[model samples]
Target: MGDDSIGGRLSEFIGNLGGFLRKFIFSVLSVGPIPNHIAFILDGNRRYAKKHNLKEGDGHRAGFVALLSMLKYCYELGVKYVTIYAFSIDNFNRRPDEVQYIMGLMHEKIEGMLKEESFVRSYGVRVHFLGDLKLLHQSVRIAAEKAMRVTANNTKFVLLICVAYTSTNETVHSVHQCFKEKRRPMDKFQEEEQQQQQQGLIKLVDLERNMYMALAPDPDILVRTSGETRLSNFLLWQTAFCYLYSPAKLWPEISLWNLVWSVLNFQRAYPYLLKTKMKRY
Candidate 1:
């Protein structure tokens, strides 16, 4: 056989072996309770770029590749919902060039996913752009809307991308929307306001229903890369009962083992989480 043919066969063999191993590992993990929803904070992209002496944009590109791998792993593990902190409202405070680069990158990626052979189609994933999408760049916002519309019928899994987002902003926006929806006759509004006090008559359900994150349930496991302990205004309200896992690795350095270990730790704490949730209800 030619040398090129031999090398190709060897590479294929290794790929198949890796696939088998992953499936075996996941089958064992299935014995424990798997998280229904997993959320991620895409941290350390800029740091990774600095550490590697690469352009800031290149680091984000690497982070995008890492994101694809994590998505594949999450889906293979039967996680129905995956949410990513793709871009935060706070991020716009960065250098103007950096913000523009990131937005362009987002536009590119969203367009890529709309292709027939893209990851979303392969996995039957529904795409949701959560939180203040109006804050996105016009081109990026249009791309996001198109992706959501294109994938609206997919039923097997979901991907929630938080761009131009902050939990505080989401909460405030939800409150405003709730008030708009609950608007009544002036006299009725006054009567309700007086009965409910200065806070108004808005119930928790009303706020929750208006929330941008209401498309999916609260995340069961929230993994923030780069050892960051803070939510950074990402999902303050939704994460109240969520398990938080911070890996020391940067976003681009996240690996299969990081995901596996997070799942293992969550499995260990499943009973406590369930019990706590039950009591709260």
Candidate 2:
């Protein structure tokens, strides 16, 4: 055989060997117990779009695609619950045109999920919209409701999408509901309420039952893409003990490898968490 032919064959063999090694590593990484619930703060959509010189809607579209891919990976890793921060209450403060465009994209994404061949159906993923629905546009709210209704019966996985959600607002809303349901007048019960408060009986959990995502398990791991370190008002009550993973990649650029790396990091740090558990109040 010619030297060129032999070299070409060797190159092909090396490429195949590398591919096999990568798959083997991923499969091994998938072993052992996975986080039962994983939450993602999907940030940097607009920044990604601007960096790529794409339109406002295009960034969100890319983000949706990324989310769909991530969901499949989560299921493969045996994660039963996934929550994503899709939209924030503070987002409504953006330019009116941008807000309208984002709402339209949200509708499109929900409609896409409703199609029979979509990932939500194939994976038996149940959708829940966790947010203050009243603040959203009527059309977007309806689309969210329809998506949740369609996926209500599925049990394979729980997908929580936070739209127009603010942790502070959710907490305040819960407090308001608690007060509205109080049987005694404020003046008459003021002393008792203060006593209960001192005893920690009137704390956030007393009102948490009324907040969105109340039924879902708190996230074991909270990941924020695009190198953002802050939680940005996501799941304030739910993420009380979550292990946070902030990767440098943008939302649209996140992949299974990134997730695996996060998992490995979590595993390494878990012993410290275990040691600290006794001290956690």
Candidate 3:
């Protein structure tokens, strides 16, 4: 046999072997306890598009398909709550054309979620939109509302989609609502100050009814794609102690195997984490 032929055969063999190993590892990782609520900062779509030399819209389309696959894996792993960072308020600063395209894509995906054949319906998933709804385009807002209304009755799993969202905005919104409920007149700063002083302390329960995620449990794990290490203003109040993982893959490249790996890593670290919590108590 020629040297070139032999080298080609060897490369194929190694590639196949690596693929098998990855599948085996993913299977093993999926067998253990899964988190009840997992959040994701779906990043790198634009970068993925650039690298692939595709249109900006194509990257988001690919990411949406990747998300569907991840949702299926989450259901299979018994995850009851999944929160995804679909769009950030910071995203609004992008080029107007790009942002418009993304908004259109968001509408399309939300509409798609309402289809009977959607994986969300098959898995009995309830959908919620968590964000500043007023900032979105009217069409996108309606699509999101429709998706939530249609899936409101599903009981198996909960999916929270964050669009036009920022942790700072969520916190400020909660505080604003809290004050509004007390009916403290904006003109009466002295009275409001006295009332706050009299209250003495603020607690999570006090803010519960004011926050957007009031009914949902805090996420147990938060995942970010494209190897980003920062929270990027996602779920700040709720993720006070959530485990965080940033895998090296872009949003469009995330797979079942990556999800499994993150879960397993969380499991390995959890016992130590519990011990630390117990010591504090």
Candidate 4:
């Protein structure tokens, strides 16, 4: 046989072996309670780029690959909802060139998601772009809207990408919406009752329903890469009961082992987390 044929066979065998191993691992994890929703804070892309002596955009490209791998692992493990803090409002303060580059990258990725054979299609994921999408470039905004429209029928999984978003902004926007919605010419008695309940007027449910993240339940596990402990204004309102796992690896350095370790930690804390969640509700 030719050497090329032999090498191709060997590669295929290794790929099959890896797939088997992953399935076995996932089955074992299924014995424990699987998280219904998980969120990610994708940090350290620039740092990863600098560390690896790559060009400025290369780190982000690498991070994107890591994101895909992590998503695959999460879906295969039966995680139905996955949210990612893709871009924060604060990120716009960076160098103008850098901001434009990131926006372009986002636009590219969004277009990729619309492809028939893309990850969203394979996983039956309905894509949601949360936050102030108006702040996005016109083309990117249109693409994002199209993606949501196309994926509207998908029911198996959900992917929420938060771009131009901050928890404080979400809160303020929700509050404003609540008031605007509540002030629509109520009856005299209703207005009087609302005034009386001014101290407790904006109920939690009202605010929650208005928030951009209302479509998905609160995340059960929030994994922030690069050992960062702070929420950095991301999901501050939603993560009140979420379990956080921060690995030392940078975003691009994230691997299957990191995901597995995070899942193991989550399983260990599942009981306490459940109890805490129950008490809060």
Candidate 5:
């Protein structure tokens, strides 16, 4: 081993540099109170495209890339769950061509997940469509179902894609089921007979148990892009104690820094948030 050996020292140095970068990334994330679940309202895809003068659907394509990066960052930061408002039921009101384009994009992504070598496979991410899935196109729905089935056994991470989802609709649908199923919405002191007839009535747990997103826990952090202040009918029931972060960046421009800051901010508020949630519960 000569001191002047070019290959040995250079390769060793490159490996060291790579390790340092990886450690630096994880160390930066270690500063925060890592959230258990993070929900994203991925807005401004169309606006981002328009702003850049890109093609009509190009903004959405870019936004999808941003989503993949966001997921990787969250995993590294120890976030176990992620729910994204991928598509709203209101999106159906858009021009038919645009709506169709979004559905086609979803189909392509779902089909990609079926491959054993894809991101969904590599990351051991479980895919869940949390909404009125029947409203989706037949092809898209089939692909979504297949993705869920294939990833059902994965417990490493959960990704809930809110396609055709609206929080208002979720509430209404849950209420309707409560009555239809003849659930007793009463306390323990009120009625013994009703309890005998049914396990319970319209309790908070009842509604939650019946929600489309019942399997996932409440989100600890909710992120909305494009500087949006309101929830826009996303995760109304599940966000009772969530720390909501609204960033000026559009969905297409969301970066690692944005996610890092979001987690840091959640850490800052976790104490107050936990106190408030405990009181509420």
Candidate 6:
């Protein structure tokens, strides 16, 4: 055989072997304890762009590609819920043009969800926009609604995109909703009469029920890209027992190995996390 042909065959064989090995390891790791939900703080996109001297939104575009790939990995590992902080309420403070670019990107992505991408259909992933809908642009709001409507029947997996979201705002909104929903057994008059009574006190369940992403459980693991360790107003109420992982890489720079490391960290704390959950219940 010619050396060129021989080299081609060998390279192809190696690639196939590598894919098999990755899947095998992922399977083994998932056998013991898999995270039911994982939250991602896709940070440092702008920093990455500046570091590479790329255009304004190029880093975010690259980050979106990384997100799509990670979604596949999460699906393979049987993660039921995946949440990403796509855009924070604070992000609007940037320059008007920059904010407009981000909103346009979000609108495009939400429109893509309505088309039911192959991965979405394959995994039965239900798309959820977790934020104040009224705060979004009218066009984006319509697109988000359509995406949710298109994926409402899916039960296997859930993909939550937090746009225009803030933890403090979520908490305040939940408090308002608690009264609107009448979560407590006591009536308004009774609650007023005995404000100090346990019946009038807000319970954990009441607050949780009113949160934007109340349908899914709190994230078992929260992966934040970049060197920062703070929550940055992401899932504040749901992070009490979450295994927070901050890799020293930008959002677009994160890879499957980063996810594996995050999973390994979660595995290390599995016993304690499980005990905590049991106690809460």
The residue pairs that clash in candidate 4, if any, are: none
53-113, model 5: which lDDT tens digit per residue? 9987999999999999889778767789999998999999999999999999999988988
Clashing pairs in 2: none
lDDT of each: 0.93, 0.84, 0.85, 0.91, 0.87, 0.88
Each prediction's RMSD over C-alphas, in Å, is 2.8, 6.3, 7.5, 2.1, 5.1, 3.9
Question: What is the full ranking by lDDT, best candidate first?
Answer: 1, 4, 6, 5, 3, 2
Where in model 4 is the C-alpha error above 4 Å?
186-200
Ordering by TM-score:
4, 1, 6, 5, 2, 3
Residue 156 in model 4: shift from native, Å? 1.1
Candidate 3 C-alpha lDDT tens digits along 1-281: 99999999999999789667756765676566568889999999999999999988899999988999888778767788999998899999999999999999888878888788888788899999999998999999998888888888899999998989999999899988876755545456767776777653455566877788875877878999999999999898888666889999999999877887788877887777557656744
Error of 1 at 99 (Å): 0.5
Give the C-alpha lDDT of model 4. Answer: 0.91
Which of 4 and 6 is ahead in lDDT? 4
Q: What does candidate 1's lDDT look like per residue over 1-281, in tens digits?
A: 99999999999999999889999999999999999999999999989999999998999999999999999999999999999999989889999998999999999999999888889989999999987788889999999999999999999999999998999999999989988866655686677776676555688988989899999999999999999999999989898887999999999999999999999999999999999888977
Instruction: Compare the candidates by lDDT and give the number of the best one.
Output: 1
lDDT of 1 at 276: 88
Backbone clashes, candidate 6: 0
Clashes of each: 0, 0, 0, 0, 3, 0
Shift of residue 161 alpha carbon in model 6, Å: 0.9
User: Deviation in angstroms for 176 in model 5?
Assistant: 2.5
Tell me model 2's lDDT, rounded to 2 decimals: 0.84
